[model samples]
Target: MTYELYYWSGIQGRGEYVRLALEAAGAPYRDVAREDGDRVLSAFGKGIETPSFAPPFLKDGAVVVGQVAAILLYLGDRLELAPKDERLRLWTHQIQLTIADFVVEGHDVHHPIGAGQYYEDQKPEALRRAEEFRNERVPKFLDWFETILERNPAGPDHLVGDRLTYADLSLFQVMSGLSYAFPRLMERLYGDYPKIAAVSAAVAKHPPIAAYLKSDRRLAPNEEDIFRHYPELDP
Candidate 1:
């Protein structure tokens, strides 16, 4: 049976994380909102005993899962995007959770005041927030990823085991989003994080992902998305 992925129609937000894993695994899935459009807003406050609390939730048969990491966790074993060893599988989930933290930080740069306010409304605070993100947070997050890749006994080719896991695809998505959101900053810092750069490059070159990127299915990052770029903030 094909899986159902529910997320906003436009913008490659958190949904891209799950999409990458599904694409790499060659899993059949329907991007629910993209097809019917109304299902997303309709899904809210309706259906299932437990509320998703947000979009980017996945539905497989009677099972419904939300949160990027949790959805990926549920899909990992089924899609072969996790290691057989339980410890490594949990480790991958840990990395993915950290990635989620990093993603929130990225989003806050533009919405420092609140998600309810416009970036223009929070421009001053966003500038301050972005300063910390660009200087302190980006390096901190990238450094951790570099260290994890180096420490992986299997090799730097993957995050958890020798094979590509949802964590790896998530990392690649982060790198891609970060690059689009901070091109100048990444160009300056990419040299210091060779392992992360290598992983991003390799993930991009993977046949399934490469084709997905070329296909109409892949949504482009934009101002409406989490990783929005304001030129002043980029500097």
Candidate 2:
């Protein structure tokens, strides 16, 4: 069955992580919202017995899953983007959860007051938050990921085992987002996290991923998306 993915049109946002896993694995799926954007709102807390709180939900037959991490976890196992061993699978899930946390924190740097409020209204708070995020949280998270890659018994090429996993793909997306959102900071710090950069490069160059990135299926990053570049905030 071709999976139907529900997310806002014109931006990757959280849905991009799910899209990455699907594209990497060459799974059959459709961006439902991209086709008929208004159609996506129909699933928002209404039609399905288990309603999604927001977009980026997956409908694979009767199994409807929301949340980027949960959707990726479900797809990881089914798409063979995870290790067969239960332990490794759980480890991948753990990593994905951490990535989700990192994403939220990164987003809050711009919208420090509230997600609903305009960034302009909270520009002062955003500046402070962005400072902390760039100085403290950025290094902390990247360092943790770097350590994970360094200590992986298999190698630094992949986040888990010898093969690529959904976590690895997600990490790649995270790195790319960071770079886009904070190019100046990333340009200075990315060298400090060589393994993470290597993994990001590998994911970008992966045959299927590379193709999807070039195709119209891929949505380019924009200020409206999860990773927004603000010269003042980032600097």
Candidate 3:
């Protein structure tokens, strides 16, 4: 049976991680929310015993899993998209978590003061937060990943080994999300991180992902998710 993915419709949000892995693996899965408008709310209302305390949950046969990273791990193992070595698998998870942290920060840039509030209402606070994100956090995080690539003896084909892994896909999603949200800032800031740029481009150019990019199912980035665009947030 094909796996079922439940997440908010329209925006990719956290759901895209699962989507990317499934797509790249060429695995069959149903995007439940996209199929039904109320699917996400219905799943939440049903009080499903979610593993990660969030949406973007996955249902694989009888097992239910949540959290983007965990979902990727589950899918990676089942689909053979993850590294086979134990050490490499752990490293992939570590990178996935770091990407998750970056995602949370991206969400905070617009909702720095309050996620429940709007960009119009939190403009002043968002400006301050975005400045910090653009000037400090972005470079720091990118530099850390760049160092990982430099330290890796594998020549950067994968975050862990020579094959495509979930972490590489997540990194691609991060780059795509950031570019959609802050095109100018990304262009300006990403210049220093060659490894990141290479990974992003490579993942996008991958056969499965490249085809997905050309498909209609791929949702466009918008204001609803973590990587939101705000003109005021740009420097």
| TM-score per candidate | 0.98, 0.97, 0.95
RMSD of each: 1.0, 1.0, 1.5
lDDT by residue (28-53, candidate 2, tens digit) is: 99898889875655755585688878
| Residues 124-226 of candidate 1: C-alpha lDDT, one tens digit per residue | 9999989999999999999999999999998999888798899989999999999999999999998999999889889999999999999999987899999
TM-score of 2: 0.97
Q: List the residue pairs that clash in candidate 1.
A: none
lDDT to native, each model: 0.91, 0.91, 0.85
Tens-digit lDDT track of model 3 for 99-206: 999999999888887877778898888888888988899889888888887787888666778888899999899988888888888888878888888988999999
Reference-based lDDT, residue 166, model 2: 94
Model 2 deviation from the true structure expressed as Cα RMSD, one decimal place: 1.0
